[model samples]
Target: MAELLDDLRAETASFEALLRPLGDDDWERPTPAEGWAIRDQVSHLAWFDDAAGRAVTDPDGHRAALAGSGRGDGPGDVAAGGPAGSWVDALVLEARGRTPADLLAWFRTARARSIEVFTTLGARDRVPWYGPDMSGASFVTARLMETWAHGQDVADALGVTRPPTARLRHVASIGFRARPYSFAVRGLPAPAEPVRAELTMPDGAMWTAGPGDAESVVRGPVLDFCLAVTQRIHLSDTALEMAGSPAREWMEIAQAFAGPPGRGRAPVSG
Candidate 1:
């Protein structure tokens, strides 16, 4: 339980280190996520972190918040509680009034509050989210995945190369678990074909999934697999090896987050 929060805090610190050095102009720079600037990414993280805090400390309030996201009573409802896609617009709209320093402060404060609340969760506890309630460990791991995925956007925008860490295992696990959701969200039937992953971590150890005998297999560095599922990189742009039609198709449409299907990056190659 303690290690879960520790890893999450470490992950948050890694991403925060990137933002702390950037100036106002850097904040305005657009990332690969369509129209989202670096500031928008940070703002989005901050907003969700705060909502997650409410989920831990005040479940009823969080439920109301999720309910409010679907209410189309007015444009304000979404800004108040919408999902990421629409929330991206709301964040961008608000970005006009925010300075880099102000946004940073918000992120720092919101995450701190959330962390404080999250530390109280037990292994058996459930945290409500956009989808069903997730266990305490899974809830925390999802935050780590979100931070790293969005951090990739910030890194790409700044043309920085981040060294992959063991943390990618978390993202890969989430990606593996999301295979069914990735297909279901697209209204496609889940493939009966089994898929496996044999990813090499930076330290040279393997993080594997599914059966070794499965005909459909995805092979790559753990980082590439994570980036693909997060939609931060096009599957074709990666050195990932996909065997069989199901593995290839799954990699193409892999989405580890809860939302409408993401507009994943287009091929950077012909």
Candidate 2:
């Protein structure tokens, strides 16, 4: 567990490293994610990291903190109060005029605070978070997943390629675990049968989940699966493969990550 938190901190650090080198123009660049600019994406990560730090250091604060502290809510709920498409619209409007350096500093401070709180926690501590109760370890994993997922958007904004990291397997696993909620959010039955997901990790090792010989299969690079769940890498992109009835069903509304089901984004290609 300590190792996982350490890795998460490292991932956050690497993500910040990527953020720091961006040109000023890069911060205002529009991403494929509809209304979010590169700066908004960074702010989103910073907001969640700060909130998670608060969740750990002051668990009994307000309901808003408790409600948005989980892995799923990081990017999803920033505009939860408004109508469809209003959240991102509002956020982008608010983020205007913020320089890339401003966003970078926000992220750096938030991430440092998060690492501090995370490192101090006992593994067994139950942090009040969105969706469900999470151990400190689970919370950290969610943060790592969020870092990688949002990092993809920043990479895309810069038209750069980030080498897929082994940590993405951890991110993909969270998305897989959220499958049931995805179905529920879409008003569908959670599948009774398990779907097999076999991903080739960045290191060329296979990470398999769910039942083999199961009625459904989702195969591809783990990075794609992570992106699919996070709604960063489009399904149409050269990232993942899907097969079987359950796999197809899952893809129709495969928002394995949290926040108000992102129904406002442009159609994810493929």
Candidate 3:
């Protein structure tokens, strides 16, 4: 738990560093996430961070606050009419008048509070989240995943290339574990056969998941796999080698983060 928290803090710090140098104009730059500016992306993170803290400290209050906003039926509830993305859009719109500094400050405060709560909680304790309850470990990993995924949008909007690091192992793990949910959410049956993930890390070490003898395999750079699973880049645009029917199909519709099905990026032509 301590190690995971350390990694979470590192991921948060890296994201903050990315946002720290941007000028006011840069905050309004449109990101690849349809209709969301850089500010909107950061604001979304800030809102969720605070919610995460509340979930740890006061789950009932969190649900009440979410219901009060008419954002959804309750905390983490996306059953309301319209696309799940609409809930996020509404939240971002509510913060339209906030300055970039205000957004940053909110994020920092919320992040600190979340970290404190997680550090104090028992590892086995479950905390309510937007979609489902999560253990202390899963909760931290979820936050890390969000921070990295959103940071990718901010980096793309600025035309900045942030090299992938070993921290991506956590992101890839989430993507791999989300395989069944990815299919279930789309009303498709998850394949009975398990898919193996074999990725080469940035430091040249290999990360492998699943049984070695599994018939399905996804092999490539960990970075590309992370981007594909996060829906930041089309699977076809990546160099990942898919070895079985299940692996290929999973890559085609992979999504690590929760919410409704995402409109993944278009393929890049060679």
Candidate 4:
């Protein structure tokens, strides 16, 4: 639990650190997320954290919140956050009246409250996410992926690189497990064979999954695998080696991070 909490803190804090240093001009900089300024991105992050916190404290309250806000059924799109353009518009509108300091304060408060809810959960607790249900630990892992993925967007907007964390290996592993689901979500044929993941941990230990075969092999530092899964780094951009039919297909549709597909910016270059 402590490790999970620390991971959560690190993930959220890194984002805040990036947001806090932005100047007025920087806030208006375009991110990889289409039509979204850096301020819009931060506002979306703050909004979701606040909304999810409400869900934890009062699930019914969130339903009412959504209802009262007239966001019912939420833009009728695959993305849980709403239509891609709607999110950008909503975020931009929300940020219009706020300063960077105000955004940071809201971010901090929402995140702190969200963590408080997590601290209260047991290992076995599960919660509903945008798509499938996830155990509490799984939910945290998903959040880690999103944090890193979006952090990449912010970093790309700023032309700065955010260092990868050892904790992200957990997210990559989750991504590996989620390949079948990814295919299912896309209405593609499920892999006839399982792809192997051989990860070299930061501490020099190793983790292996499935059987290495014609399917695929993901190797090198665990961080590379996580980076690829979160779309922070392209599969072709990293040292990770992938082979086989299913592996290649999985890489194309891989979405280890949470949220709806199609919105998160896929890697443009290897």
Maximum-lDDT candidate:
3
Question: Regarding lDDT, does 1 or 2 come out ahead?
Answer: 1
Task: Give the per-residue lDDT digits (tens) of candidate 1, residues 140-236.
Answer: 8888888898888889899999999998998998889889988987799998989999999999999999988999999988988998888887788
Candidate 4 matches the true fold with a TM-score of 0.82
Which segments of model 3 are wrong by more than 4 Å? 63-85
Estimate the overall C-alpha local distance difference test score of candidate 3: 0.82
How big is the RMSD of model 3?
Answer: 3.1
lDDT for position 33 in model 3: 75
lDDT per residue (tens digit) for residues 1-270 in model 3: 888888999999989998999999999998887678899888888888887888889988866765677644322211111154576778888998999999999999989888988897776888876666677777788789888988988888999899888899999988898899779778898779989999999999999998899999999999999988888888878889999999999988887877667778867766
Query: Candidate 2, TM-score vs. the true structure?
Result: 0.84
- Per-residue CA lDDT of model 2 for 99-208, tens digit only, reads 77777787888888888889877777798766566777778888898787677777777788988888887788788888888888667787887888999998889999
- Can you tell me which runs of candidate 4 are displaced by over 4 Å? 60-83, 86-93, 211-215, 263-270
Q: List the residue pairs that clash in candidate 3.
A: 76-130
Worst 10 residues of 2 by lDDT: 74-83
lDDT of each: 0.82, 0.72, 0.82, 0.67
Which lDDT value does model 1 have at 261?
74
Q: Which pairs of residues collide in model 1?
A: none
lDDT of 1: 0.82
